[model samples]
Target chain A: MKVIKTVNIFLAIAILILSVNLMKPLSITGSSVADLSDAECYFVNSGVSNDIPIDGCCYEVQKQLECKKTSKDYRCYTSESSERYYVVNANALNYCKVGGYDVKII
Target chain B: MSKLSEDMSKDVKLMIVLVVVVIILIFFNFDSYGVSGEAANTDNIQYEESTNTLYLDSLTLKQKIAQMVITYHKETNKERLQDLFIGGIHMGAKTSKEEFMNSIDNFQDGSIIPMFISVDLEGCANPFENFQEFPALNEINTKEEAFKVGYDEGKLLKEMGFSINFAPVVDLDDKIWKCRSFEGSPEEISEKAKYYIDGLQENGIVATSKHYPGKTLMLWDPHKYVVHAPISRNDLMPFEKSIEGEVSAIMVSHIIADGYANSENKPSVVSEKLIGELRNKFTGLIITDEIRMLGLSDYYSDVDQMYIDLFKAENDVILNFDINLDNLEHMISVVEKAVIEGEIKEERIDDSVERILNAKGVNVIR
Candidate 1:
């Protein structure tokens, strides 16, 4: 009886502690960030694309669309940020891969 | 009686306690479901056939402006809330059931026309402690489940005295992990959202599809940042689907649509460009996402102009829309003052009040 009482009291205490922990404020997790990469640097070096400039000290969005025979599962981060997720596709991914900084899959 | 073994008795005792606990939880669930809202005005909605212009004429310009402004209230102060003469009250999810009833009662008692009580029962963890926790829309997979969830939520909300729900975010950006969105392709969002819209509206609750024209990127939340969406007409398909599905209201976001809202690149809510686009598309209640949102607020140096511009852009309802009562009062005053100066006509205010009255089922015989 004594052992059972002791075990039940411990269990109650544990549950109480857990409820308190669950009520604590949670730190909101935001998305990850990265610096501009080398391929992007190469595109910057090649200043040929009319739509986008190669003066490239600043991080600006350049949208490039590529579609093939089959619409394979492709994901590009949005054509620009702040728009919601782009329709998941790879052409957008490749576009960001070539010229954008911090490209991500939608 | 046979002498039970000591261990067996202990086991029986534990089982009885577990059963009692389960019964208590069940009873608590019933109490949770038992919460109800004010039901005086909603029984009749013969709005298309007639309008109450007599009541409309009776309202002072300040009363009409108050009818246009919807504010978030945490407490149920009958005198103060009635004094504000606000048309709508957004009940926070955190408000307790008893207090929520009190708030609704005060609003009903205070106002001649019952205020449109709204809540965000987003089907995730409900913000209110006494309310039942529903699984997020993302957890729902099939059309049948979505309809059931939407119907039940709408019915419950009506019972709880909420005529409007700011939910089922139709934005294509599912990466933000708000769990408020129905994810997948835009088509999938449209298909699923139709049922949710129907479920709520059909049940007499106004379902509002939000963060309009699509919150395109997954990178940052608009609540914290000046979200920029460079979307084309093709991106607007989700809004089209939700509207077609018969949602009664659409909440526009403050996200700056670079290619869309205009060259000035104002957030869509205040922009004549985007809001004008919405007017072309939807004639229902065009509610703005909390007008106080940073995405829209940071742009206007003169905050009073923000409210003026929202209605100037022809936004029907402003949500949390003002900074404070003083700010709210000033915004109304400026709008009222503008009408008097002929910068804006009183007909515009009448048009807005008409929509609000119709939604609340305040109709005139003639």
Candidate 2:
């Protein structure tokens, strides 16, 4: 009876481990967002500060912040308000992640 | 007892099978576990719906002409070159050909915009004129001399990966005292221009015949201020012949042509009737003399407006000098604004950008 109980306990532990492993998450990142069809939201932060030289759409930002892309990081200013919202697809969240800033999923 | 032992073996096999299945599932799940929350959020960020092919397809007629306009020494940084929306660079006597040639290696890496290399070699006495380092072809006097000079320079430029050359001043020197002119008559100038352009093109360099509508009678350099040319249509015969010969690119002179009703008192480079109506008489590329010249700069209060006008006038390119990173960004913003306002079409922008990329020998992503 003890031998049978031991086998049953081993099988139960294996199943539990497998289920836990399956529940883990996934993410992605890069210069291009073209491949992110599955993402729920997306944002481009050209990392730069206010008072520095800027061009294109970044200049239109009312805060006068410089939006520049660095080698390994992107820089830009974002508010905690509704202005920070991004449009993205659902599967994209499974494929990529954000760096250098705190981003909330919508 | 034997049957009972067999059943125990089967149970052991079943346990092994379950463990194998669990291992396989964990291995596949590992990839998902590695993704961070930050990356997941980034993937969900909103982006404009644009494809690589769509970007390439957005070229317009005006932008196509803009692509043919080449500049030298105006803007040096990647961001600034992006603003001019130009297809090439015309390196003047001031730029060292060797150093300029060596810079091509750096361009192999991708950039937001592309630039081509073109150099002015007329009246350049320096050994490194047009970036040719060889000892034999520095000062081209005879047709035979021009052959070697053109061939060797074109070869070097090609090896260095330059795609264009704005050279072989085809202007007739009617006035012997003019230091800039090389003492060639209209016929001789035409012949030499043909030979020089042909030699360079043969070696895979796009040659540009410049100082269009001629520059023989200008009293002062247009780079400092507006210079008047006293010559008539007869004096511009060489330029007409260059167009007839199908030169790849032609640069308009800043000097206003005398007795020409539409262009008098106005530099031919900026005049709509000249660059647009008259120059458009031909099919090749039409480029302005230089945007930073006092002739154009003094007249236009807003520099961005000048580019918009030039685009509207149908000239393919504008040569910009005294441009740096900051100014380039402003120029790009101006163009973007123009697009947003419907003053310029997105197709025109893409066309110019593609030409710039082609001149740089890089593949356009769109």
RMSD of each: 20.7, 21.9
Give candidate 2 regions above 4 Å deviation: A1-106, B1-55, B58-76, B79-86, B89-99, B111-114, B123-142, B174-180, B221-224, B344-366
Candidate 1 local lDDT, B1-366, one digit each (tens): 234467757855775565565555545433322212322132222323333333566566666677787775445344555655678877543335666676677678736577888876666434443445466777777777778888988877777688888887777755534465787777887777888778888778988887777763344532334667777554677789887776788888777776544425777888877787778878788888765434565576665566678878788888752213434555566677667777776777788788888788777432
Off by over 4 Å in 1: A1-106, B1-54, B216-224, B260-264, B321-323, B364-366
lDDT of candidate 2?
A: 0.48
For every model in order, the fraction of real contacts preserved is: 0.00, 0.14
Cα error, residue A66 of model 1, in Å, equals: 50
For B1-366, candidate 2 gives per-residue lDDT tens digits of: 998778777777777777687777766554333221222111221223342222344443323343455543333354334333445554432244455555554442343344566554343322243333432222346666666677777887688666666665666652311222434556666666666676787787877776777763334431234566766564566667767766677777666666642464676776777765654477656666655444554456656676676665555666643323233333444555576688876665555455544544445656
Q: Evaluate all candidate structures by whole-model CA lDDT and list the values in order.
A: 0.59, 0.48
- Native-to-model Cα distance after best TM-score fit, residue B151 in candidate 2, in Å: 2.2
List, residue by residue over A74-98, the lDDT tens digit for candidate 1.
3222122212222323433343333
